[model samples]
Target: MPSGYLDLAELEQRADYVKTFEGVHIPGLLQTEDQIRAIFAASVPKLSEGELEVRVRFRLRRQEILGGVPYEAVIHEAALRIRAADSKVARGQVLQILERSEHPQVTVRVVPFAVDGFAGIGDPLTYAGGPVPQLDTVLMDTPHGGAFLDAEAQLARYREVFSKVEEAALEVIESRQFIERVVRSA
Candidate 1:
């Protein structure tokens, strides 16, 4: 509750579809436990071991929504390249992404560095599609908390932004291959 996890989790649970874009780090739902642990270990104020484990469990629990609904993640190449923990952990994390991409309800796309006319290197965003167009919400996470937008205009803008970002990414199959290359290099 203090982390606003409950609010975001509830929204994801009620949504029919979820799409996320990440430029700096892997999306939480797709992260491995080790990866999540590494991320929490870097918290500014620092968390105790108990607190870190609790957060990790909460994050892992949130991934259950992916099994019930379609989830699409369009991640930038930079996120794939960055080492969240160590080489072993980073490689393991990408491998997990590759494995998850094969799921029927999961789609993973890559935006390579060679792509031209691309400018979506800003903060990450998650667009959750509600049952009706009027119910859709766009979520952007900040250090302070989650920001939810449901106004027609704001939703339309984010939808367009997500469309453009998805267009810039490689196809699912190509993304798998690209990730394989990254794994091999690691």
Candidate 2:
């Protein structure tokens, strides 16, 4: 498969070979149906009702990696707390994360809000597999669209930042508990 907008699709096809890092909100690969609908509705408000459903289904299709693949995510506490579209939607999102984290192929960690001056403080990113074992790319989310970075230097920097962010984040079990607490509060 060609790379670009279909990067997520490619990742799903080659699920065993992908590793991802998400700084804001849960990664699409881990989002629930309700959470995905809310995100698409807000992000693409111009879509007609029918188009919205199509897009949400497409987004949910990306979650196949959670079933049988090696994937990991490092999410920030602030991102988890922000209501994607509304409090109800956000609550459901947290529950989804809690459920998905139990899978053997998935690892979800939370970077606490108290972490001082983290590398991924301002932006959320996606890292995808490349053609080679040591090759990979970084995709940064933008207001206009996603920007893909394939240069080795840029990918290296982002990888280092992700490593640091993970170091500053809660352990997998702790992160799950935090998400459960948030869901219960909602």
Candidate 3:
């Protein structure tokens, strides 16, 4: 959800729980300003400096939900290891993830390289709950752009996909430890 999307505001306000997955990039809500700037700078067509600032601000603003909502972020080890900017930025990100994991509302897990049967490589998703289970929406990332899936079958399949990936992830405590080791090597 970006700054001016009324729909994003409304949905987030009414949601009971939010779940996210990141395989390549950091999940949008958990990304920091420096990381966001680095990503925008690396974009193919390249966003104007003004647009980049706007996006970074929007992303940081959306992060406030980490304290308000029950959010679960399942990230992969590969995403954790890649230094989008540099070691300082990566270390800050890992520390941020560790700090936020202490919040009662946020749950962060990492799927390490040793994990098996985890084939959700191309899927990046945020499953936002609604007033009722039937109203939930699955937001997915594709090569082209973002996609929203709301049909029953689609929802069921995505739910299963998320479940399996989450199953392969390290426990919260272990995940933090795994990230700490990464920082040590960095």
RMSD values, in order shown: 1.1, 2.7, 2.0
What TM-score goes with each of the models? Answer: 0.96, 0.86, 0.92
Instruction: Sort all candidates by TM-score, best to worst.
Output: 1, 3, 2
What is the C-alpha local distance difference test score of each model?
0.91, 0.74, 0.82
Question: Per-residue CA lDDT of candidate 1, range 109-172, in tens?
Answer: 9999999988645679999997798889989977677899999999999998998998899999
How high is the lDDT of residue 148 in model 2?
Answer: 75
- Report the poorest 10 consecutive residues by lDDT, candidate 2: 1-10
Give the lowest summed-lDDT range of ten residues in model 3. 1-10
How much does candidate 1 score in TM-score? 0.96
Best by TM-score: 1
Writing each residue's lDDT as its tens digit, candidate 2 over 58-152 gives 77777765676677788877778877777877887888788888888788888877777675345777776646735676778877777878788
Better of 1 and 3 by TM-score: 1
Which residue ranges in model 3 land beyond 4 Å of their true spot?
Answer: 1-10
RMSD (Cα, Å) of model 2: 2.7
- Models ranked on lDDT: 1, 3, 2
Which of 2 and 3 is the better model by lDDT?
Answer: 3
